[model samples]
Target: MRTLKAGALYFVLVFGAGFVLGSIRVPFLVPRLGARFAELLEMPVMLAVVFMAARYVIRRYALADRRTRLLMGTIALVLLASAELLLAFLMTGASPSAYVASRDPVSGSAFLAMLVLFAVLPALLPSGAVSDNPFKPKSVGGSDSFKR
Candidate 1:
């Protein structure tokens, strides 16, 4: 339930943030940076929101399960990248030369570095951090507790 709420919050934040940024930049940044930059910025924000959620999940439950967290993060990054690629096709009909060129060309390390940053930030919450879980487990009729 916390994850769902966090995801919903993430979606809303990213959606509204996109609109707000778009509206402000429609006449300026959008033209200078092109639709691609605006889009690239938006997707990262959404992914960050998701990462925030995942971080919360990790800290709140003390899951401490790196595999699950890493998988969740990798999935988010791939989805974001796919969305960016698809949006590139839709907006410009071709990928910008600058898009790939702007990064460090040393074995594609910079591009992969950004990917890693997004993939890992969510799991960097301070040790022993905790989140308030409103929908946490509750005791049933017997002594067993049901996980929400």
Candidate 2:
């Protein structure tokens, strides 16, 4: 239902960003820096995308319940993994096991960690902090009371 929709949107946002970043990283960064360093460089950007996308999906869908958020994250992870494997199969004729085995060990481990973070982030994020401004001070009195 709502969780499904939220999950799909989250997957689209993060996956789309990754696809674009991969496009750049493969042809440009990989040759210059090597796979491990290129992938390591890309990790921080992907992490930011994951965090922002998770926050956006949770807030937009009103996914306040912990179970609901977890379900959404899981759904998104499944979709993302499936899409990646399918693309790898089509592009390189690599089986899933072969595809995984081919990854640079250091970069691959980081990628695995990112995947775990992606799966759990929605559930872990606080639901109450809906304010757009991160630095806005909490209000103490009537006139300055923070407004949603």
How many backbone clashes does every candidate have? 0, 0
- Indicate the worst ten consecutive residues by lDDT in candidate 1: 2-11
Please, what are the lDDT tens digits per residue for candidate 2 over residues 1-148?
Answer: 9999999999999999999999999999999999999999999999999999998888777777988999999999999999999999999999999999999999999999999999999999986744455446546576656666
Q: What is the lDDT of every predicted structure here?
A: 0.53, 0.92
User: Where does candidate 2 have its weakest 10-residue lDDT segment?
Assistant: 129-138
RMSD, candidate 1, Å? 8.9
Q: Which residue pairs collide, candidate 2? A: none
Error of 1 at 143 (Å): 25
Candidate 1, residue 2: CA error in Å? Answer: 12
TM-score of each: 0.48, 0.89
Model 2: residues with Cα > 4 Å off, grouped in runs: 130-148
Candidate 2 deviation (Cα RMSD): 3.6
